[model samples]
Target: MSKLGIKDIAARSGVSPATVSRTLRNPELVNKDTRKKVMKAVRESGYTPNRFGSSLRTQQSGNIVVMMPDITNQVNAGIIRAIEVEAQKTGYSVLLGDTQGQEARERHYAQMVSSGQADGILLYTHRLPFDLDNLTANLPPLVNGNESIEVEGLNKVMVDNVQGAKDGVNHLVALGHRRIAAVLGDNNAPSNRERLQGFQQALQQAGIEPDEQYLVQGDYTTESGMKAMEALLKLRKRPTAVFCFNDDMAIGAMSVLREYGYAIPGDISIMGFDDIRYASLMNPPLTTIHQPLEEIGQASMRLLLAQLSGKNSAPQHIQLPLQLVVRQSTGPAPESD
Candidate 1:
């Protein structure tokens, strides 16, 4: 009576050890009568399967690490919730890693998967934390969520950022706004680059040349938005409308406009991306792009699950739809005083 093992449970249930192992590892493969007997024996024996030992032997931890560049971003909260819920449904757990845009932290979290502490990874950063060459030798299952970083053999679940930004900017262009300003996220980020491209594309389609003075680079923070707006306001030819890369930046710019005694959509219109919870509750409701964040999260986790189960031989990419949500914050270009 030193310790209980699978052989003890198999002996008590009158089944082979393999059958007992299969029953515990995958109950669906075993028939009902056999499964019930094995479970009954397991209950009677008070034998809890050693998860760590099983993982060590099988090389599967049943845990996925979700790495986010910025945990404080409100938009990421929905994605995390969806991932956690879906993972729990499949008898898996989630380990959250907030890299805070640091290369060392991202690499450290990726190492956990290679070390068997996690079976897979879900990345929200613009680039992979670890080297591609090292990962190729023993590729642990990896999925990209929300942000798209082009990799040769990685699945990505995201909204079309370029199209979403184009739609938001087109809405302003249709309102006769030729002098539109842009508050951009990290200039070096792929997502921001795609969005800026869309902004310029939309203006070009409408026969308006993009003015460099109206383009302000931000860090996707409210404080950056405020400073960018202040610089735009000082321009001799102020923009009649402004588009912020994210809701927090848009809200910050709006606050600055208010402090300057400027009325929203009357003196200058404003719009943003990522229709966050606070968008609709703003003073004049924010116009923005709606991304299915929860769906993006769920799809990424499901892709990783498929990879872990050997259901996918090649990478799978999914692009969710985006919509232009028109609220009161955006309107026609104001007349010059």
Candidate 2:
């Protein structure tokens, strides 16, 4: 059977081809009654609009692309769900792409924007290629979600990492933990840097000097967390408390500590960031900083939609607030200390 054509729907709907095209590309330009009529006629006639041709004419794919460093992380799941919910409300669909934290994979997705396969791109990758500015010049409007990259004119939605980290550390300090260690995510990532700075600031505020020997770096992975814990345990005077950049790493560190016969919150206190779903389910619930993952996702989608709608609004940099959720993982410093 021959494929359905636009002319068939246009003829049946009593609308011109140009009107049908506008209805598909910019539905807002068409009245509600006309759009409903056109949509019904198209659906009744089994008409599938040629998105590729429409994209070529209007420089829009009618689709949004979302790229994240890792898709399996629980935090990322919340973010994706939020973005999808908001995107659906605007008559847009999202194409999720995972780069697995590789520069080449990130660039591949970025190139999709230039090719008109996506109207805009949402990036949650960290340590993106340094040449992002050069690449951005050739792509569609881009937005950062939960991760900041250095690119002028690009909008961003992030949480207050520094303040959150400081709050976590101050909580530990208040619990009488003086010799605190940290398992950090990628040192180069902006969020990690901010968190580390906040930790240092909090220590200084408590009249404690930053101890480099107690700090270990990880890649925000459970395995890396385990390794970092191993290194931290080798310290001459092990920390009485440990702060992790994220829940995954914190959980990893906890596993290692348990293997080494250290009782959580009894031998050493532990804290984490990004209060992921599993944070509250561990043997000893994790104490963590709650980042508004869903809100960040919604905000990023809203920003992209606003740009697509030709709203001449200022580029936005939304910094959502963070909260500290205390639980079983953190307690007063060990009596032995």
Candidate 3:
């Protein structure tokens, strides 16, 4: 039996060999029906294209770099897992770049694309690394995942933070809480900034004025949540409800609440964003706005793949939907004082 090759796939799929090659290299360039046929033929015949030889001929790298601040975070892990799965479907490898919140480290990773080591970049950050500026003459495609950058002309896949926050806060408002507060993460991050805006908007809509003192900054850690909760406790008139930027922060705040002998929901209703796995396993399960991490990653990969295939269009912002998961953490606001 002859070894299956591109020609065999083309013959089996009823397409030219060039079409089979194109579909294998950049599936997005081939029409859906044709791509499907070629893929089916390849699968049935167990034909694996010579990726190394193909890369050399095309002067391309079958690799994509995914940059993120922290890979240890469950949220980041979930998104990257999905991105890898999606990239693998198209014969591309994903290179994980943990920036560790350092500028130099980020620049080092960005150089991979400019140096022809990776085809493109997927970012979970607000700024394109400075090193990429030198490659303006031939910058590879970039797709932002979850986090948003200030630069224009880059596609993004993220949830609507503003709307998600509003929905969470509105839930508290509906529960008759007037003295509401927020434990927000890094204000520099677009998602956190948008969530803060949403919290304010929800308050305004509920006829409650935004209180500056109630808006505390957190670094999106459990420790930051604890400190934010401490600061709120020091206020002359403490808030009856609080919303956290993420579940970890919420867990931090909850721990402080317990230390000070405050009852969850009974004394203060708490809410959070980014429904991580542990959100439901806390002493009192947390109610949070759920960001579809997997879907966001998949969308980001698809956007980058489209650009890599020369499917040009205006930059797209694919905002995925958010769900408000209600659990044991929140309840009706406590009766006045």
Candidate 4:
């Protein structure tokens, strides 16, 4: 049999082809009785509209670009999987853009928005890939994942970084660790700053003074963690427990701690944030704060889909919950040496 088309559907539904087209473009434009007849005929006829032609009329590529600051990091793996799954359910595909912390690469991916290569953008970084200020018009639909930035017109899905950090530090303090150290991420990152504030709050509540010497700067990299651990180890009074900004850095610190003949949680306790996959499989099993990675990804895509469907207005921000997973890596403070 020959392929069925919109005209055949219109004939069977007893309506003009123009009405059928209007129903497909905007269902609200057609009355309820006409829509029911058109859809019933559509089901019986099994007519599939030409996607390319629809895109030409709609100016939507049905593609979303997901920009990751670091593609190799395990923290992004679960989130990316969730985003892809949700996008597929809505008849959309994802283009993974790994910016690798390079401004130039981010700008390149941002070009896809204006070039009609992507319908929307999901950013895992805190900053925009392009300079929207350069244009007088509004930017394309943008949804931020994990990182929360307060832009004029953007949506964000994130965890409570400050409270999560406080929970981790409070856990350490409850275990009798008065001298605790923090391995921090970049000072400029908003998330890092919030986490640091939580750490300080926990210390103050416990009547422990925040030691400048115990604060080590890291870039959320394993190498930075290792170097920071070295400085912490050289201090006259090493921290009884150390809280790292991320799991990668905590793992790096663990390696150096072992090299220095310190047993985890026995000689010194360790805690990490963003409990990645390896957190549970570590030698002593890392104690850490868990960010809802999959949920964040799902929410980001949901917001983007709403924007594309003309249902989204005004800026929205979603802050997900965080939990602390206690494992063998953290223990009570050891006897004073």
Candidate 5:
């Protein structure tokens, strides 16, 4: 029963101690075969590096912080899982911080870099504070996933919200839905604004005038969705179909519609964005725009790792595509009753 050290693993793997350390700290820097050999040797030798000792030697915490606007939202769960897997592969652990959509909390988590608690940060939140430029300047390597900000030297992995919204609206239009209402997210976020603009673009392409009365804003919450539905129902000219900015709101709206004795697709068609896991399990299932949550997570981590390894020179802005998933929630508008 011998305590294994870096030298022991390095000798067993026929590599230098520095190589072993690099392999443990950042495997992406090593060739895949070399990394596999190093890991196998470490496992066989029962070598576990002392995190405290390693941190002291490298002047790094070996921790990454991920900040989510709302952790309870199921849409972020997949991304978190992906990040966890990839971060583990890089010998880094993740600390999750839920900001609850609060600017102060977001700023607090972002400040961890300067405090030396984390080596990097991953932000998946709505619009950051306007002064985020000054904040990001002092932070360690930061990457954005499922959200966008205009800060320089930051990497972003985002889905094409505009195209996704346009596709969602086009599907409704094809199903004979001309009077379409929209339940949009917060107007302050670029993603929400892009979705609204895309929805409007689709209508304009069809020669349909945009109706302000059919639009309502939500905070991307289920309760907001319910309230928006109530408001939309009270409009003088009710829409025949409704498109929600996200699946959470769409599900909320659907519940309210059912409680009001309205038949789904029979009275009004409903569609949502972000095809979360529960979207297909709802009573009637949901028609939604599918975002690659897992892929976004993986890609963001890769980008951050690249930057950390000094292999990536310029900031990268990646926009993944979206798919329209048609389920039982949407259909042709019912004939006038």
Candidate 6:
């Protein structure tokens, strides 16, 4: 929408400049026929808006770098695809950098962006990859996604993990679950920490005392989830219900429960976060919280584009909504723990 002249569109479509502006900026204000005419003219012109202006001193690469923790993750894969689709519509491309949770790999991507190899950045990380001392130095425009960094003036987009977690746990409590547990993912992630906070808050609201022994840690992997569930089963008073930080961990925990001859949602119930595609395909299906993965990717790209076009100078934080997906995995708690 930026950099292209409105007058040319008006002249080609035989409409007034104001009409062209209205059609481009707010198409809903114009009649459908006029809108179609303007769009046809735009298409004939073969115009794709430039994402960045001539603001920086270095040459533009027409590429934006997206540094993610893991590329093989289903959540990350969906997000990356959406980002690429959105970027292509605006005459820009993406340069994906998978950090693999390695600090050195993160730094490598950080240096690539700062060196003018890309026009801007979309970070899916808990913290900035580069050193804090270079915070004020020459870095490309950036927008954070999936997880948040505490740094000032950085735009961010993510779901409310705490509230989401609370809602997931509260679902189990409403079903008469008194002894509930949580399989937490990597605590280093802000999302995981918020989920933990929510888990505690839900229990306190339900008049259930917080028990440190009920909390187990996982690294957001299926193997880690299995390990966490194994530890929980070893407790003398094992929990009647369990909540996992992500769907992958939940799947892992479910497998362990099966191996131990436990009937899901009959003897115990399970809840998970991030309703990935596989969540619904599980044996009993997964009852989990849904994060809008595609929306996160598209929203992050829009945030960076807003900065690149000088439309927004202030940082903006977008907290997307989360949905509670009810499936066969969660049911009324058994009479005995």
Task: Work out the TM-score per prediction.
Answer: 0.91, 0.90, 0.84, 0.86, 0.85, 0.82
Poorly placed runs, candidate 4 (over 4 Å): 1-51, 132-137
lDDT of 1 by residue, 1-337 (tens): 7688888899999999899999988999999999999999999889888787788788888889999987778788889889999999999999989998899999999999878899899999888887877665566789987778877788888778889888988899899888999999987678788889888898888899879999999989999999999999999989999999989999999999999999999999999999998899999999999878789889999999998888867778898888899999998887674
CA RMSD, predictions in order: 2.5, 2.8, 5.6, 3.6, 4.6, 7.2
Candidate 2 lDDT over 13-119, as tens digits, reads 99988888779778999999999999999878878877767667767787888998878888888999999999999878898888887888887887777677788
Against the hidden true structure, what lDDT does model 2 obtain? Answer: 0.87
lDDT (Cα) of model 3: 0.89
Model 3, 1-337: lDDT tens per residue? Answer: 8766788899999999999999987888999999999999999999988766677787789899999999999899999999999999998999999998898888998889878889999999767786555544555688887778766577888799999999998898888889999998976788898998888988998999878999999989889999999999999999998999999899999999999999998888889899998998988999999989889889999999999999989889999989999987888988877
Tens-place lDDT per residue, model 5, 10-118, is: 9999999989999987888998999999999988877889777777777788788889977777878889889999999998889888998888888788777777788
* Higher-scoring candidate on lDDT, 1 or 3: 1
* Residues 24-53 of candidate 4: C-alpha lDDT, one tens digit per residue: 878999999999999999988788887776
Better of 1 and 5 by lDDT: 1
Displacement of residue 151 (Cα, Å) in model 3 is 1.8
In the predicted model 4, the residue pairs found to clash are none
Report the lDDT of model 6 for residue 181.
Answer: 91
Off by over 4 Å in 2: 13-43, 127-139
By TM-score, the better pick of 1 and 2 is 1
Give the C-alpha lDDT of model 4: 0.89
Model 3, position 237, has a per-residue lDDT of: 92
